[model samples]
Target: MSQEPDRLFAQPLAQVADFVFNEDVARVFPDMIKRSVPGYPTIVENISVLAARFAQPHTTLYDLGCSLGAVTQALRRHVRADGCRVIAVDNSAAMVERCSEYLHSQDSMFQELLPVEVIEADILALAFQPTSLVALNFTLQFIAIERRPELLARIRQALLPGGALILSEKLRFEDAIEDELLTALHLDFKRANGYSELEIAQKRSAIEKVMLPDSLQTHRQRLLDAGFSQVLPWFQCLNFASLIALP
Candidate 1:
């Protein structure tokens, strides 16, 4: 319930990243994302905008890669208390397990008041019900580039005719100079937050195999190809953007 680090930061690294996750790396993720990405708040702000667009009396919301359910919890406030149910999905068993435990441990008053369900599932091979609001927040880039279209298509089919999907991602800039500038800023932020230059470099090297960032143009094209009627980026902050697409 508390938003500060004292409460949110207390999560163990194993729990945050799941068992294979590095605690130190997990501990610094929040700071790293904030520093590495500009317009991060836009991602938060767009949540309200997206909510208003598709809001219903009791919507069934799906939060893909609900990392520790941080954003998931934030969106709960916007939904009317009795009508919304968040089905949080994540692949990391460790993170899901810990999140479930934490949710259970929440004060009884809060428990009696909110409706949230956290589960472990692969987004790429998921089954969505007819009525659902799907969100892929800063998680789509991690999926293999070739698999994104198929995944999006599946999500589109799962939604009702008027269902909405909100997607946010870290994009690749077109200009080499811009890329370098953003990279430098991100690296500096990491260093300022306690990661050494060497450590940051090593981490980047390790994830290079899996991190795939597409340009904004490429992303919009993909959404259209996936059968979205309107793919509009309502918010853009540097390389980070929040996209709203309709099926």
Candidate 2:
């Protein structure tokens, strides 16, 4: 799909509001994420590989906070389990609408891809079905910290035996020095991706109030506490990482 370059923060603003997944953002998200996030393409592709391993017959796979259905498309393309379907959910109306269009486009091109359902609902309030794989790709960070544990516990309860949850997030290192170094590296990465200093700074200011990151230690403990049998780190680049939690 062709994407417009992300220039929302290219110009100065007297006051920046917390970032939102509205129409303007939804329009430019594909470009924005690719430039802002390191290892994003790899992560999206690998989520399908992990899905093929964990997906069970007659169960559903969920992509929570699914933006434009990238992971959902990957899952549909890779997972061939009988009776399996994918549910992609996002609270943003614009995101859901665009995601539906993208998925429909995929459907027209591919034959017998896994069936999918796209929902415009808050994941925190949605009840999950029997699920074999659940993906929270850079999603949990946007959720309020106090509510995260409950959401994980709910996912755990919904998962069938041997099911897995793939969580990808921006990490916060426990050590101040490590945190600083990794953060600097991430900013450098953005610069290298062609984002100007003003764009980087303004974007950071807009997102800082909304996206709160956690250390790997905190994520591990929280996953264990949520009734996952194991929490394993599968991928990491700079301060971003993806984990698998088996239930």
Among all candidates shown, the one with the greatest lDDT: 2
Q: Residue 112, candidate 2: how far off, in angstroms? A: 1.9
- Indicate the worst ten consecutive residues by lDDT in candidate 1: 1-10
Q: Write the per-residue lDDT of candidate 2 for residues 1-247, one digit (tens) a residue.
A: 4489999999999998899999999999999999988899999999999999999999999999999999999999999889999999999999999999999999899998999999999999998998999999999999999999999999999999878999999999999999999999999999999999999999999999999999999999999999999999999999999999999
After superposition, the stretches of candidate 1 with alpha carbons farther than 4 Å from their true spots are 1-32, 45-49, 105-114, 192-194
What clash count does candidate 1 reach?
A: 1
Candidate 1 residue lDDT tens string, 1-247? 2222212223233322211233333444455456556666567656855765575556677888876665666566565534767788888776676567656665343544347888788888777765457888888988889999999998888777666899998777788898888767766655665565555555565566667889888988999999889998888755677888988
In model 2, which runs have C-alpha deviations exceeding 4 angstroms?
A: none
lDDT of 2: 0.96
> What are the lDDT scores of the predictions, listed in order?
0.69, 0.96
Query: Would you estimate the TM-scores of all the predictions?
Result: 0.80, 0.99
